[model samples]
Target: MTDRPERDALRPRLSGGLTVEVIETSALGDRSYVASDGEVAVVVDPQRDIDRVLAAAGRLGGRIGLVLETHVHNDYVSGGLELSRLTGADYGVSAKDDPPFPHRALDDGDIIDVSPRLRIRAVATPGHTFHHLSYVLEGSEGPVGVFTGGSLLYGTTGRTDLLGEHHSEELARHQHTSVRKLGDLLPDGAHIWPTHGFGSFCSASPAEGDASTIGEQKSANPAFTLAEHEFVEQTLAGLDAYPAYYAHMGVRNIAGPEPLDLRAPTHADPEELRRRLDGGEWVVDLRSRKAFVKSHLAGTVSLGLDGPMVTWLGWMIDWGAPLTLLGETADEVAEAQRELARIGIDRLAAAATGTPDELAADRAQLTSIPVATFTDLAAAFDSGGSGGGGGSATDGELPAPDVVLDVRTRSEFGDSHVRSAVHVPLYEVTQRAGEVPHGTVWVHCGSGYRAAAAASLLARAGRDVVLIDDSFDNAAEAGVPLES
Candidate 1:
């Protein structure tokens, strides 16, 4: 579910005496909560940005008293350690992880009092991870809401694939039981607050709505409606590929993540950029995919600023490698940096704001790639076409590519794709690019966003590339030969 909150306020208030202020990180489309009862504030699943969580608590007339994490997160870094150090709050991490940082190892059934009238009781909901915990915010009357991190979501549960591919089926069955347990324990009237439903790729199934209640889910959620075996099968089939960075988050979180530092992005001249690029360093361009495909600096890669920039950046770029960013403005660079910080990518070699003229001062260095409609390439292939130089043979200037590189995910490619298309997912293209025979390579995604990125990478590797800048929905209508 996509939440449309005001510029500063949290959305969909949970019904209770507790003041629940949501700090939804819209860049990653994930939610964190600040719940206070006039005196003590309890923060849940905070991102690396801790100032906003503190500010939200202050606005509600309370100081932060506790930091809580429901599990070892697989999406982004948890700010619990940093937030706890700065605020002197007791940090709650699941006991099973045995986190290295100073924290209270929160266990199932443990109750932490927030105020005279408010308490948070932890419930063992081990579906998201092996030791996941869900907290039920309790008032004088009873339960108010359950902060179900990734265990039990509005319509589904967290993906079990994160643990290991081998454990997925086992975990899926466990998730079903855990979800049912939450519905059994929490009151029907209690509200459901999940941290992953927005755009976080943690859920096993799609998040159905903005919010739902324990009673509502009990009546409608798969845990209640479908047979346990059917629910497991449906969930396993529904799981999609998560970002590659997810593989490292659990280990990083256990080691203890560093607090975010907006390492000042310094200005670098064209010469410095050239030296870095020549030395095999990365220059990530933060522009619209459209702008990038139209014009970009030679040897630079495109992972546009507006989409899932951080996820791709973290996935594709080597953690130890020196990286620089190029954006049209300082604000654009900073915006990309902020999102990167959530995943604990706190530093960059440098950040520069550049213009086309500066990049193209040396005429041969001016880079521009064209978009291909699916049909144009289809017809070329219909007449025994493989790509010539990654560009159109139809366009006389470049060599034709031998491969039609479809940069969409494996799952997307599996459902439906052109019969001639080769699958090299956008993130893994860097390592796998050498496998493609020398020719013009056609690259595309469901949308054109990642197509620009894929083409840029292949071009940087000296492969002739074309960006298929059309929607995938047009494939069948365009008379392309498709295979499932």
Candidate 2:
């Protein structure tokens, strides 16, 4: 498993006695904030895991007095309601959002006084979602900062398309107006703490920098710098596909998600594991890509815990389909479980922990995939070996692959990709697997993570596959033909 930094590593002190502790869920690329004023704390946009927030408040020696939600989040399940229930803090949700649970119906211009020195004001942002709110923290002197959840990110705003395509354009316009409103209302020095866009697909475009100020954003942010029409057009045009699991998040948030369950799942023996695979259930291998490529049980897809396993697994799997995890250790499975819970995939059918040999019924159940680099791929092409068809090869030159499947995003593919590579994004690989031509398929992504996952899916489908396990940056340098 990859080494994760402490979640509350970034504790930035704001004006007055208030200090903001950031709880980052890097797997999902979102941050939850715990703003404490020595005695009392207010949490903003918390993830499903509340223990981290509780720990942040504990470090500050404060009581959590308020929990706030910026909107009905489309990315992950919110911990606000349960956090409020656990701490007896008043839960705040936008008045426009009709969540099933009881919460303070926060409206625009509403001020919540946590102490004599610290107060929070709710401002209707209505960009990322129609009911989105940005909370401005006020000190005795003036406004200190704003929690712009999915509204005004570091350089761009959250993608407005999550609501649906029909509403994307309208929401983009709202996003434009909302970000400018925040810029106009806040002071130049006011810090902007956004919840999304630290590599999250929620971002309209790639966000820049870790920290930003209202003044800086005004000059750099599309909403502040571009005309309304231009901003709306640009945002809508830049939109890409988000995780399929997202379709369930908003609904779950609105209905009030079940309390988190992080306990260990039932242990499955090798025979039980085989049964799960035979029943058409998803059995994900939570090992490193290299380990998985070396050996894993057949029919088990590689979604290594070392990468964005939660993101790709949620996107590629059939929602609500039974899932079983195979990890090298209990901790690896536990970590994967915790990440899955963030996106509201709570129940695990079962899990097995051991080496592939320990988990497989026999040697026949074990399999391996050939790992290659971009240079190796280039060499294969140069060798003029016929594999899959449908490649653009000149006379005497080998076709790119039986099929050269580019599993990166459309935007990445459009930027520059190997010549004649088929473009099936990682998210669409499950349904579109048949579309891939018959032959030895060579799959690649920006990095090897998605490629490994795609290769596993192809392998599970009984297709011969070679995993190009190198960075895309080396493609051109390695003499792999590329075109924009």
Candidate 3:
């Protein structure tokens, strides 16, 4: 088992007797918070990992009195139901959400007194979702802080397109009004505690900083600085594709996600691993990209633990596809299992731990891909090594790539990219693999991680691939042509 440390909790002291402890899930780019007043606590927008929330509350020496959902999350399964069941806390969800669970239905303007000193007032803040609510933490003096779930983030608001493109414009307008409402409802000194926008895709754009207050946001946030139409226009224009796994999250949350199962999965022998691979199950290698590029079993995909493994794997795999994990140690596999469970991938088909040689039937089953830097790529392209005319090169020399596949995001591709690279974002690689030009394909992304994953996918699709294992910043420095 992995001897992983507990999730880091950032405890920020609020006015009055309250203190807010932040439980961050950095992998998912989201946060859950526990607001405690010495004796009782409230948990807001927790990820499926309930243990982190419990640990935070325990550290604060407070009993959990309430579990609150800001909205029906589109990114991850909520642990609210399970947490409430375990702690006997009143689970508070928006009344309009009508989730199929027993809880205290919260409406706009409803106030719940946790003690004589601390009270939570629910305020309707629509836009990220139709029924989103922001909870204001009120002390005897006035409001101290507000938990802005997906409504008002650090610098930007939550993306309005998660519901669907049809409602995007309307929601964007609503989002503008909602953010302004918060600014007007609270004093400038009230601290702003938001759930999304700390590198989360849920944010309309990238978030600016780690912390802020209403006064800080009023000076910098677009909703406060820009006109309503301008804010809506910019917000809608910034929309991009989110993870495909998000489709399952809202449905699961509304239906009430089952408790997480973190027990070790069944162990698979070499023969069983081969059989599963041959039968088209996803056999993911959870090694470093360098190790994966050096050697892996044929037909297995590389989703190195060094990268956004959970996000990319969940994005690329079929929802119910049987998944088998390969790692160097039991601890590595356990860590991956915990990460997967956060995104509602609670069960693994099987797992194997060892070198590729040990997991393969023979040395013949092991294969390695060519790894190249941007400098090598530049030299190859400059030497008249272009696509379509290739016999496989002998020895370790890569044949000039037939195609340079840019597997970065659309926004990244739009900003600047290799002059002649074909754009196919990593998430769309499986469905659009056929469109890639034939011959040896060179794959690259912002960093080597996505490129390695794309290279593996291209290899799995029966194409010869060279993994560009270097940073994109080196492209120009290494003399690879770039076009904006």
Q: Give one digit per residue, the lDDT tens place, for model 2 in 1-484.
A: 3324554337877778788888888888898888888999999999988998999899987999999999888889989889999999999999888777889999999999999878999999987999999999998888989999999999899999888899999999899999988988999999989999887889899999988999999899989989999898888888888998999999999999889999999999999998888777899999999999989999999998878889899888888889999999899999999999999889999999999999988779999998878887777667663243544433333234577899999999999998878899999998999999888888999989999999999999899888889999999999888899
Residues 1-484, model 3: lDDT tens digits:
2212333336777778788888877777888889898889999998887988898899888999999999999888899999999999999999999877898999999999988777999999999999999999998787999999999999899999888999999999999999999999999999888999876778899988878889999999999999999999899888888999989999999999899989999999999998997897899999998999889998888997776788899999999889999999998999899989988898899999999989997777799999888888787767655444453442257766778899999988999998878999999999999999888898999988999899988898899999888999999999988999
Per-residue accuracy of model 1 over 17-84 as CA lDDT, tens digit each? 67788887765757899888778889999988787788888887888988999998988988889999
Q: Can you give the TM-score per candidate against the true fold? A: 0.91, 0.96, 0.96
Q: After superposition, how far is residue 263 of candidate 2 from its true place, in Å?
A: 1.8
Every candidate's lDDT: 0.81, 0.89, 0.89
Clashing pairs in 2: 388-402
Q: How close is candidate 3 to the true structure, as a TM-score?
A: 0.96
lDDT, model 3: 0.89
Which window of ten consecutive residues has the lowest lDDT sum in model 1?
Answer: 1-10
Write down the TM-score for model 2: 0.96
